[model samples]
Target: MRRKVMRTLAEARPDGLDPVPGGVRAPGRRRGSGWVAMVAVAVVVAAVVTVPRLWMDGRETTATAAGTLDVAAEAARRQVPLPEGNYWSVTTLISAEESAGRYRVTVTSKTERFLPRDPAGFQLLAMTGLHTRPLTAKDAAAWRAAGSPRLCGDDTDCENDVSPVGRHRYTAMPSLWPLDDSGLTLPLSRLVELPVEPAALRERLLALWPAYQERMKDWPPAPKGAALPTRDTWLWSLSLDLLATPVSGGTRAALYQMLEDLPGVRGLGRVTDAGGRPGAAIAMGGEQLVVSEETGQVLARQDAAASGRVVNAVLFQGAKWVGKLPRLPKGCPKVPVRDTDCVG
Candidate 1:
């Protein structure tokens, strides 16, 4: 039955929507599949949202660069009210670049998800307006010099003699997607029970580590004497994973507070995300997050190279409650599969 479910998920997602950075996906699932389902479950958690604001203490606040906004304060003040609706709608823009011969190619795609408030209702997923182009001016020049050949690499959904530019697809999930990965398989109810205070939240998150390690014991052994990550590293990663989901504003504020207490996290002041949205940034090693200055909402999660160049990013455009789903993109038709809807 598990295998059958995995196959169904694979068949349902044909447009190849990538997941957010640092998310742990289950086996037989796409690399970013956990992020997708995690958000669906997030809406369920938000049903009874509204956590009390906690104090932001024991952390040194950093000053921003000139003309930068105070994103930390904005994040700490997050407690957005849950709007009345039957569906939770989220939109994200995914940007990624890959090395191809002499130059690199960048591809961008938009993903929209409408998770029903009712647990039994179907969740709609759509990927549209997939566009691929050269990563930089130098790469574009090189590509033009190379006879402007079609650069179809992995992650491109192009078939024989077809271009990968501007493809769209959609899927309708029959059940509420569970957050299944990283040794944890939590449902919406479980997520809603998490603590809102930074310390309490940290304790609750750390309590799950033992189970994660136990699950890892069954996998292939690490290299001889490979050093495991510190507990703080684990906490940082897991906290960011939760932040990537459609969690409540209070939960998001706690996550921001918790991340600040960890080592290596620094404020990047104001900057533009890959999607061209201006936001304040906080970075920890190669992973970084950008949040809206006005709403403190997470704008994007980026993975950068040692040189600080972003190789992949997932932009959180917006998420809110809606009464109905949007129509499918033109030039796409519906599929006749059970418990599914396709457009594009």
Candidate 2:
């Protein structure tokens, strides 16, 4: 799942990171989220549709460049209705604080069981430059039946049986997209108490961009007249920075209001996720965000798949002030890595 092209972005690391290759960046330095790519594909059958990008160019602003709060405040004042559609939502954030509030964020994404065989599937396999023979229908069926092959091993004919003629479809795996700070766990503290005033909050957030630029090695320089590269990028960076930050509820509301003011961001009307959860969606770029109207908490963030379904979906189902951070259970699944964030 390719991210819909957007103008520019300020980068921020997830909580608790040390500057290092493959590590979340330190504070005052731009960083990446730890979760590079997130994914979950189902075997269910469905009609295919072309993916749609729901974004447009928006004026870029600096964190210090104050924005009108009325737009964001309006969003907070009115709960948006959502569309009715089946979709999948996943837990993306779970932060507990000692003597503070625990916050959880969910993301919503889309995926397909399979891609087209001839060009699509074959092209994907060929990208690896490994498979020699052309995949056949039998191989494809077997691959699909086997829940899609995962490279056959010795004593197993999975590779030989389905390697020819592209057995299963290929997916961009939007859910698994990478970010530098995805694994960082934020401390239950705020660097500074966030300001409730929209303009003041914007200025404070903007001040963090210089550090972000210092850390960004290859990202294109931001647009002219813009303190940060792009509005979307800056907001994204801010979101990651604030996800588990021990900020006041007023601060969070201000952030949301600021986000609502961004150009191109608008209500998603009404929509259901693959998980059959109903949410009011906000769309921008190649992503659709489902948020809770009542609490104004972000519920899910999903990417659009090539097949026109949601991908890279995650749900922040929980975000509450807590007394202490929760403890991770032993043997936590390390599918992606060894980190405090992984639940399974």
Candidate 3:
């Protein structure tokens, strides 16, 4: 079940001189009385100024602490659980910049669902490289040696050679993204042991929002009133698992530590979601995470600003998550076989 939380600020009133009573002249005051009144007024003014400053400082500290705790608690809530059955997820990426090009990528992940295979199933596996730059000659040669077809000429030619309709659609390929290795889990696990500092965390969150939106432009726009979640939305959710240390109260402390230690933290500001809930955005290094106010769940995550190069983003819903992969479907068949067999 999803829960929503909202933050609201209250207005403050300034206390100072009351209107002079009915414009009546004060009864003549003795000289001593005048000095006493002046002293009293000075004291009041000092209290007014100093008290507010102290109060403001206290409030700021409290806000920072509260925000940090809230983040950590939310992270604990979303930590990945040991699977009782097989799990699967798919992710998609659309460029946020118009000049980048018109292509999106999608990826799918799968794990075993039961015991005996638990070790392998418990292992996290991911597919990558589909949206990456075209393969190199060495990469192609390795694929060929592994039974993949040889390219007619170059990478482009090699891609054409593997065209599914005109050729065989093999069940597997050695050149596919590596899903068999242990990934960044260790580095991520280490991130959740630091401290909680919301101001710094907020800044990091805001930095990633633009990076995600910038890439959104590359995706075909969603239907009106529909906006896709940012890449950070997903990363934040995944990071929750790393934060789930038993000693850290399951995962909350782990998450707090991760947020505190996130390097090059930047904020992306408040993102307005179509669902009418305020969303927080952030980026850590190349990864991004967006958190929803309504669900308190991360909606998206991906490498949005990694050297302005190809990166993967994952989207999640409950236990389901998707990874973005790059694979173009075969173009329409040519009526007359010619040099230009494909059309854009």
Q: Model 2 over residues 1-344: C-alpha lDDT tens digits?
A: 34332211112323444556666545533111111111001101110111223233443323321233333334544533222112111223211100000111121122221111111111011111112111345544543554442432110133222112222222232221111232222222332266866568777766666666566646566578645345465565455336323355566567666665666565546567544566566555545556555555556556654454664344454433322222323543212122222211
lDDT value for candidate 2? Answer: 0.36
> Which tens-of-lDDT digit does each residue in 108-204 have in candidate 3?
2211101111222222222211222214455444444544432121112234222121332211211111211112222222333333344444454
RMSD of 3: 28.4
- Report, for every candidate in turn, its global Cα lDDT versus the true structure: 0.56, 0.36, 0.31
Q: In candidate 2, how many Å is residue 213 off? A: 1.8
The parts of candidate 3 lying over 4 Å away from their true place are: 1-72, 75-83, 88-117, 121-253, 261-263, 267-269, 272-278, 303-312, 317-344
Residue-level lDDT tens digits of model 1 in 125-236: 6665456677899989987886776644223323411212365456665434433344334543345556777788778787888887777777787689664545766676
Off by over 4 Å in 1: 1-70, 73-78, 116-123, 152-157, 160-167, 172-178, 183-186, 189-193, 225-230, 324-343
The weakest ten consecutive residues by lDDT in model 2 span: 38-47
Q: Each candidate's root-mean-square deviation in Å?
A: 11.9, 18.0, 28.4
| RMSD after Cα superposition, model 1 | 11.9
lDDT of 1 at 86: 64
